[model samples]
Target: MIEYLIGIAFCLSSALTVLILLLPSQYDPATKDKPSVQILVLGDIGRSPRMQYHALSIAKHGGEVVIIGYKESDPHPDVVSNPKITIIPLRPHPAILQTSNKLLFTIYGPLKVLFQIAYLWKCLAYTAPPSRWLLVQNPPSIPTLAVASISCFLRQTRLVIDWHNFGYSILALKLGQNHPLVKLSIWYEKTFCKSTSAHLCVTDAMGLVLKNDFALQAPILPLHDRPASHFHPITNPQERNEFLNGFPETESVRSSLAAGTLRVLVSSTSWTPDEDFSILIDALVQYSELAAAQPELPEILAVITGKGPQKKMYLEKIAALEVAGQLQKVTVRTAWLTVPDYARLLASASLGVSLHTSSSGVDLPMKVVDMFGAGLPVVGWNRFEAWSELVTEGVNGLGFGSATELTERLIELFGDDKKLETLRVGAQKESTRRWDDEWDPIVGKLLGLT
Candidate 1:
C-alpha cells in the first residue's frame, strides 16, 4: 500500500502543482534589476516536457526561470538544469502519495493542492520578487485558481491560465460524469477562468467549449504542446545498441530482428483508467486470433512503458490472457524506463499506439505528440474534436471507436512494412514542420507585460 501510494505520486508527473511568479514591474526597484520568469508546476519538472519548453522559452528570451515542483527521487536535471533556470522543489505531501483508489484521491486531491500551493506561497514570499505575469496550469487542484487569482490581484500582475480541460472531467473519469462534485467542478472552473488575464488551451476544441459553453471573457489562445528538437530518431548503431541493452528482454529478442518477423509496437501509458488500456489489450486479443489463423503473419511485440497503481492489476490480467492461450505470435512486454530511454524506444519502434482518450475530452495526449516527434506514427482513440485536430484519420494516424475497429486498424498498420513506413515518413515530415511558430508569439505577448 505504501509503495502504491508512492507510485501514485510518481505517475502523476503531469498533473497538479503550480507556479506563482513574482515578475519585476514599474512599482518596485526589482523592476530595474533582472526580471526573472519563474515557472511553477506542482508536478514533477522532469515529468513535464511542456514546462521544459516553457523554461527554455524564458531562457531564450534572456530571463531566468525558477521551477517549483515535487519529485519522489533525485530531480532530473535534463529539464531544468539550465544555467538560467533554478529549481525550488516542494517536499512531497502525504496527499500526493495516495494510492489509485478514487475515494482517496477525492479526499486528498484538494489537500495536495492546498499543501503545495501554501508551501510555494511561503517559499516565494521571501525569495521571489514582484513580477509582471503569472501563468498557472488549468484544471489544477480546483482551489489553485482562486488562490492564484488572489495573488495576481495583489501583485498587480496579469494572470495567464493555460487550460488543459476542466479538472472535473478527470474527476468524472475517476468518479462519474453525472456526479454532483463533477458538475460543481465545471461551475468552479467556469467561474474562475473568466478572472484570468488570458486563457490558453491545448486545442481549439477546448477553446470553443470555453467560449461557447463557459462564456469566458478572457482571450483563448490555443498553444499546442510540442517536444524539444532533441526528441528524434537515431541512426547510430552504438547508440541504438546501448538503448536496447537497457531492456534485456528486448535485447534477447534478436531472433525477430534477424528473421524479419518481428514487428514492434510501442506505447507509453500511465496505466490509469482514463487511458483505457484494456481496449488495447482486447484489440490485441482479437489480433492474436487473426495471427493464429494466418500463419504467414509476422511475429509482433507490444511494448507498454510506464508505472502506475493499475500496473499490477493489468499485469495479472495480461498474464491470464497469455496463459489461457496456445503459443501466441504476438507478445506483450511492460517496461518502466527513464525519460531518455523512453524517447529512444519511441524513436526505434516501428509503430506507436496510444490508448489515451483525453479524460477531459479536450486535452490532447502528450504521448501522441512525443510519438510524432520521434518520427513514429500513432494509433489511438478520441471521439472529441481531437479526431480531426490531432489524428487526421487516414493522414497521420487512425483513431478507432471500438475494439473491433481498432483491431482491424492495428492489423493493417502491422501487416505491411510499406504502410507503416509511409506513416513514419509522414510523422518525420510533420515533425520538421514546426507548430511552435503558431503559439510562441502568444507567449511573448502574454509575458511582455507593461
Candidate 2:
C-alpha cells in the first residue's frame, strides 16, 4: 500500500511541473495572453512616422508589439516605456540599394530584398503563435510580400499590409516608369498583395489603386495621418514662451536681431529629389525684397527643418544668398531635430509653409496635417485633389500655384495682421474634426474583434 501511494505522488508531481513549463509567466491580466504583433518596415522609422504610430496604436490596445525596422532615434516616452512593446532595430541599408543611379540599383535591388526576407524568416520563426500577425509597411511592397506571404503561410500567421505608395512608382523615378523591370514589379506586387488578410491605405485615391488595379478584397481601410495626442495648439502664455526659449540658436537670433518682434515663417522639407526646396527659398527671397521695400513688414526669419540627401546642396545655396545680402531682411536657417524639437518648433511658428507636392500624386503630405493640428495657417503649394480636404482656399488657409503666387500670398498675409488672425482662428477650428477616431473600426476588424 505504501509503495502504490509513493508511485501516485511521483506521477502527480511530474505532471504539475510540465504544466507550469508550458504556461507563459509573462502574461498581464490587462492583456490576457493577447497575441504578439510584429511590425516590419524596410526603411528608417524616423522617416516613417506612420509605422511608429501604428505600433503605438497596437500597444495602446493592450497587445504586445515587436517593431522590426531600421535604426532610429528613441520613440515617444509612452512607446519606450511600455513593457508590452519591444523594439528590434536593424542596421541601415547599403548605399547601393538606396542609390538613384539606375544601373547600380537594378543590379543590387533584388539581392538586398532577398537578404531581408531571409532575416525576417528567422525572426518570425521564434515568435510564438496562436494569433500572430505581421503588419508589413508596403511601398517596397512587392519584394516584401513576395517573401512575407510565404512565411505567413508556413507559420500560419495572419498578414496585414499598410500601403503608403507603390514601390514601383519610386523605382520608376530611377529606372524609368516604362522599364520592363518596373512593369514586372507592378504585376508582382499586385499578385502577392492579394494574399494578405487586409490592406490599409493612406488615402482614397490609393485605395482605388488597391481595389481597381490590384483587386484586393474587402477590409481595405483608409487611415490618414493626424497629429499625435501630444500635439495641440498650446494656448498658455507661459508655456508658449518656455517652448520658444528652449531653442537657444533661434532664441538668440530672435532676441538680438528682431528684438522679440521676429516674425517666423517655418517650413519643413524632407530634402528629397522629388521636393523643390528652391521654390520656398525663392518665395522667401521675394518676400525679403518686399519686406525691405516696405520697411514695415515684421523682420522675417525662415526656419526650415528636416534632412535628406539634397539638404546640403540647398543649404549651400541658401547660405550663399544670405552671405551676399541678397535676401534683405529675411534669413534662412536649417535644423535637423528630434521629434520633440520639431513639435516645439511648429508650436512657435507664426505661419506654416510646406513645399511638398505628392511624389505619387495621390498621397497627402503629412507635414501640412501636423501644421494644421498646431493651429498654424498653412500656405501650401496647390498640387493634388486630396489636399482639398485639408487646405480650404480663403477659409482655413490659402493655396498657391507657384513660387511667384506663394510670394504674393505671403505678402498679403503679413501686410494685414487682422486677416492673418482670422485665418489662424480658422486653422484652430479645423483641428477639432479628429480623423484619428476612424482608426479603431478598421483595426478592430483586422484583429477579428468586430
Best by TM-score: 2
Question: Considering summed lDDT, which 10 consecutive residues are worst modelled in model 1?
Answer: 18-27
Score every model by TM-score: 0.85, 0.86
Model 2 C-alpha lDDT versus the unseen true structure: 0.74
| Candidate 1: tens digits of C-alpha lDDT, residues 2-32 | 9999899876753533232333222252654
In model 1, state the lDDT of residue 180.
81
- TM-score of structure candidate 1: 0.85
Tens digit of per-residue lDDT, candidate 2, span 1-450: 999999999999999998566442232234445666778887776677777777777777766788777665556666677887787776555655766567777777777777777666555544433237888898777557776787677556679998877777776766778899989888888788888888888888888777887777857888876777656676664676676666755654657343555667888888886568889888888888888888667767788888688888888998899888878777677777777777777766778987777657767777887777777888987787667766788777898879999889888887888888788888878766554465666775576433
Clashing pairs for predicted structure model 1, backbone only: 17-42, 18-42, 19-40, 22-130, 22-131, 23-130, 23-131, 23-132, 24-131
| C-alpha positional error of residue 67 in candidate 1 after TM-score superposition, expressed in Å | 1.3
Cα lDDT computed for each candidate against the true fold? 0.72, 0.74
Model 2 residue pairs with clashes: none
